[model samples]
Target: MEIVTRADRPDLRETAAAVFKERWPEFVFHDEVPRRYTDRAEKYFGLFDIMVLDHGSVVAGGWGVPVPWNGAVGDLPSGYDAALVRAVEAREADIPATTLSFMAAAVGESHDKRGLATVVLQELTRRARDQGLAHVIAPLRPTWKHRYPTVPMDEYAGWTRPDGLSIDPWIRTHQRMGARVLGTAPRSMVIEGTVAEWESWTEMVFPVTGEYVIPGALNLVRIDVEQDHGVYVEENLWVQHR
Candidate 1:
C-alpha cells in the first residue's frame, strides 16, 4: 500500500469520496458548515488531504487544514466547524498557520482492522512536520460514543481501560500514537434538517417532537414535529499530538 496526497493524485479523488461515503453515516453529509468549506479547503489545501491505496485502489483517507493557533488548549477552536472556518479565514487574510487541525479520517469498510487509520494519521502528522507546523491536533469523533449517546462527551472522554488508554477505539488509537486529550467540544458539528429529512437520513420514524436516539448518532437528535424541524448537535474530543 502507498500513501499519496490528493493534490499529487487528483485521479484518486473519486475513490476517496467513495471511501468516505461508505464509512460515514448519511447524516454527516448534511452539515452546512462543512459543506460550505469542503470544496474550498480541497481547492486551496489539497496537500493536506492524504489517501492510502492498495494496488491503486483507495483504502483509507484523511484531511486537515492549517490554522493559526496560540499553542494553548483553551484557545483552540470550539470544534471542527470553527476550526475549518479559522483555516479558511486565515488563508484569505494571508496569515501563516501554526498548526494542522485534522478534520476527518476514514478507512473503507472492506479494509477495517488493518491499521490503515494509523497509517493515514501518521502521514498527516508527517506532512504537518514537514510544513514546519508547531502542532497537530484533531477534533476526534470517538468510534464507540455513538453507542452511548446520552453520555456527556467530557465524561465519555475520561473513560479509560485498565491499561489507562481510552475506551473508545478511535481515541485509543490516537492515545497510542502519543496524542493527549485536550478537552471536549460539546458543539463540534451541528446538523439540522426538516423532520422528513431526519427520517430519511436515519431511516427511522420521528412521529412526535422529542429526543430520539438514532443509529450512528453520537448524541440525541431533537425532533419537533410541530415545527417541522430536527436538529443534532455532535460533540468531539480534542487531542493534541506530541
Candidate 2:
C-alpha cells in the first residue's frame, strides 16, 4: 500500500477536493469547496499544509491532512482562547499547550473496515509532532458528523471505530497507536435527521454555548445531508498525539 500527501499538483486537486467534499460539512459551514484554495486555507494549511491524500487507485485515492485548526475562545476551561492564551496570561508556557483542531477524517465507504483511516490519522500525528505542534484537537461530535451518507463515509455514529471493533477494545487500540482519548466532554450534541432538524438544534444551543470569536469560524450552518449537499454533522471531538 503506497500512501502519499497531496496538494498543488494538477491531478491531485480532484482527490483533495474529494476528501474535502466529505470532510467539510462537519466543519466548514460552506456546502461546496471553492475552485481554488482561499484565505481559509491560510488558517489551517498555510503552505502545502491544507490536506493529505493517500494513494489507493492511481486516479482515485485515499487522503488526509496534517491540519492544525484553532479552538473556540470559550472552549478552554478557563474561558480563554487557545491554550497558548492562558499560558501567556499566566506567564507559563508549559501549562497550556496550543492545540490544533482535527477538522475531519473520512475513509471512503468502500474502504471502511480496513486500517486506512488509522493510517491517515497516524501519519497526521507524526507530521504534527515533527512540526513541533503541542497537541491535536477536534471539534468533534459523533452523532452530528457532517458527512453525506449518499457519498461514501465510515458511518459509525458516535465515536467512530474501525469495523467490528468495540469500544472496550480501544484500550488496546490506544496502546498500539500513539493516540489516546484526552477525556470526555459533554456539549449540546446533534443528530443527523434533516438539515432543518440540526439548524433548529443549533438555534437552541449555540447562543448559550458562549460567544467565541476566532479569526474565522467554519460555518456550522446546516444543509441537508444529500439534498442540500451541505455539511455532514455538527458534533465535536478533541484529540491529541503521543
Candidate 3:
C-alpha cells in the first residue's frame, strides 16, 4: 500500500468525500436539523489539506483535518466561530502555537487494513509540523459521542468531558501516532479511569445529568438516551510532536 499526504487536492479530495459520506451519512443531519460534525467538515474542509489514495481496483480512500484552531468544538454557530477567532486573536500566547484542532477523517470500509487511516494521520502530522502547528486537537461532545442524546444547545458549549472511554482510544491512537498527553482537563461530563470503571461510571452518572436541566428547553430533555436510539461518536484531540 502506498501513502501520499498533501496540503490540498480538489480532485482527490472530491473523491475522498465518498468515504466521509459513509462515515458521516447525510441522514445524521437530515434526521436532526442542526447537521452534526460531518456537516461542518464538508462545509469547511475544502480550506485544508485532503489526504487520500486511489488504490487500484479495490476502493479509494482519504481523510481530512483542519489547519490550526479550526475545530468547531460543539454546536459552532456563526457567533461561536467568530468568538473563537476573536479569542485566538486576543490570546495568541495562551493557546499553544502547535495547537491544531482537527475534524473527522472520512474513510471507506473497503479500504480498511490498508493502513489508510494511519497513512492519512501520518501525513496530517507532517503537514501540521510544516505549518508550525504544535498539536492536532479534536474536541467532541460526550453527549453525541457516548450515545447520550444531544445536550441542550444553549448549555452544550459548557458541557465538559462526560466520564468514560468514549474518547480515550482516540487519544491513545494519537499517542501511537507520536503525540503526548499534555493534559486532560475535566469537561462538564468526562471522567478518568480504567475500562471497567468507565462502563460502571457511565451507567451510574449519565442519568444524573438530567437533574441539572432547566426544565423548559433542551437541558430539560432527558439525557438518559437509549444507547440504541442515537449513534456513538467520539472526538479525538491530538498533538503530534515535531
Candidate 4:
C-alpha cells in the first residue's frame, strides 16, 4: 500500500470521504457538522492528514489537527465535536500548536488484517514529531463498545482482557502502540435531530418519550416525542501517544 496526503493529492479528497463513510456509516451522521470545516481546502482536508491506497483503491487513512493541548488530559475536549471546534479556534487565534490531536483513523473492510491502521498511526505520529509536537492524543470510538449500549463508559473503559489489556479492541490496539487510556470522554460526540429525522436515520418509529436502542448506536438515544427531537451523546476513550 502507498500513503498519500490530501495536501499533495487534492483529488483524493473524494476517495478519503468515501473511505470514511464506508468504514463508519453510522457515526458519519454527526460527523457532517465538523466536516463542514475540516473538509475545506484551506483547513484540515490536507496538511497533516493522509490516505492509504492499494492498487489505486483507498484502503485506510488518518485525520488530525495541530492544537494547543496543555498536556493535561483533563483539559482535553469531552467529545469529538468539541475537538473540531478547538481545531478551528486554534487556526483563528493564530495559536501555535503544541500537540497533534488525532480525530479519526479508519481501515476499509477489504483491507482487513493488512496492518494499514498501524501505518496510518505511524505516519500521524511521524508528522507530529516532525512538527515538534509533544504527543498525539486521540478521542477513540472503540471498535466494540456499541454492542453494550447500556454500559457506562468509565466502567467499560476499565474492562480488561486476560492479558491485562483493555477489552475494547481499539483501545487495546492503542495500548500495543504505546498509547495509554488517560480517561473517558463522556460526551465525545453529540448528535441532535428531530424525532422525524431520527426516524428517517434509524428507520424506527418513536411513539413515546424514552431511550431507544438503535442499531449501530454506541449509546441509547433519548427521544422526546413531545419535543419532537432526539439526542445521542456518544462516549469515547481518551488515549495519548507519547
Number of the candidate with higher lDDT, 2 or 3? 3
lDDT agreement with native, every candidate: 0.92, 0.38, 0.39, 0.81
| lDDT tens readout by residue for model 1, 166-233 | 88999999988999999998788999999999999999999989999999999999999999999999
Q: Output the lDDT of residue 131, model 4.
A: 77
List runs of model 3 lying over 4 Å from the truth.
1-9, 12-14, 25-47, 56-98, 140-171, 180-242
| lDDT of candidate 2 over 3-102, digit per residue (tens) | 4544444465566566545533333433222212333433334322333334544222332223323444344331112222332333222333444444
lDDT of 3 by residue, 108-161 (tens): 777666656666666665666676665565432222432333433334333434
Q: What is the lDDT of residue 13 in candidate 4?
A: 75
Compute the lDDT of residue 36 as modeled in candidate 2.
28
Q: Which regions of candidate 4 deviate over 4 angstroms?
A: 40-45
Which wins on lDDT, candidate 1 or candidate 2? Answer: 1
Please give the lDDT score for candidate 2.
0.38
Which segments of model 2 are wrong by more than 4 Å?
Answer: 19-38, 42-98, 143-233
The lDDT leader among the candidates is: 1
How many times do residue backbones clash in model 1? Answer: 0
Query: Per-residue lDDT of 185-214 in model 4, one digit per residue for the tens?
Result: 888877888888888877789999999888
Ten residues in sequence with the least summed lDDT for candidate 2: 210-219
Name the weakest run of 10 consecutive residues (lDDT summed) in model 1: 6-15
Question: Between which residue pairs do clashes occur in model 4?
Answer: 79-188, 80-188
Cα TM-score per model: 0.97, 0.46, 0.45, 0.93
